[model samples]
Target: MPLDAKTLCLGALEAGFDTGYDIRKAFEDGPFQHFQSLSYGSIYPALNALLVEGLATCDVRNGDGRRDKKIYAITDSGRAALKAALMEPLAADQLRSDTMFAMAFVHLMTRDQVKRILDEYARANRRLGEELGRLLRDRMCEHPGHQFLLRLGEDGSEMWARCIEALRDDLVAALDDTREAPEAAPTGGAAAMTARDAPETREPGSGSRPGPDPHHPRDPR
Candidate 1:
């Protein structure tokens, strides 16, 4: 199932996280690191909503005169909700990658730009693989499921890094071939200009623009 932010927060509490920050950290560093991501923008609001709905309780802990911290714990109702959510049929997996989308237009980019992109992508995956390796070696590999997830993340990162490196080599070879080829006459025309100026397609329900409002008057002047 596609777990909402609130359900994820509840699960974090069930997993022993006490605050919204802790919940975010759980996603960043724990077994969920590979498959899930949560930001404070979503985490704090979800925690507040959970408290309002009586699914969770918050404790105001006094700090050392700097700031107070709010710790959250799941209520019985929250536990029931979490369990029900887990038992629900899983939703289809969603894969969203802005990198992949940009790759579709790689031919429009210079070789240097393509190389830079591939370098950054490989570096990021390498860093993630290292972090997962450390976690698996240290505390996170005790549980069977945690161990499996950590290994999955570590292996996936390594595989992606290798794939990106291969892509870099292929791109470089293609660029070399393009440079060696004889130049053709420029094909500049209205059709080419229109194609270049056309806007990229946006996904459905992307909400990049507001829907029409019946109450608003259109300005004709």
Candidate 2:
């Protein structure tokens, strides 16, 4: 199931994040970060909605001496709602990658750019995999689902890094071969076809833009 901000906040409360900031951290940099994301713009509104729906409650309390803090807690109804949402059929996983998107248009980029991107992508995945592995080794997450996710993330990340490493040389070689290939002179008919396809200088025109990547994760605050 594609969970929404309200359910995400409810999950955080279930996990013991009793403050708005704490709930944000749960998705921002805490255990849920690897799989889900929510921003304040969505969080606050969802929290308010839950409150109005009698699914949550808020209490004012002392804070850092200058301002009061509002603590949030999920009601029994909220837990039931969360449980119901979780029981729904889940959508298949989606992979959205800026690096992969860039690679799709590799012919338009310089060889150096492609090399740098591949190197950085591999290093990033390796680092994330190592971090997830450490968490798994430490047994940091007690929940069976959480433990399973940590392992899944670690394995996926490591495999991606290895794949990138294995393919880098071949991709670079292909780029080199393309660059070295001679440009053949076009025949008169071929020249006319090329001219027809090309946009003329100073011509004002428009075409459809690329649609959004449906697989992308939610934007961060």
Error of 1 at 92 (Å): 2.7
lDDT tens readout by residue for model 2, 116-196: 999999999998888887877775778887778778888988988888877776677655654443244254555333333
RMSD each, Å: 14.9, 10.5
- List the candidate 2 regions with Cα displacement exceeding 4 Å: 134-139, 183-221
lDDT measured at residue 15 in model 2 versus the true structure, 0 to 100:
83
For model 1, the local distance difference test gives: 0.76
For lDDT, the strongest prediction is 1
* Residue 4 lDDT (model 1): 95
Estimate every model's Cα lDDT from 0 to 1: 0.76, 0.76
Distance from true location, Cα of 158 in model 1, Å: 1.0
lDDT of 2: 0.76
lDDT of 1 at 207: 37
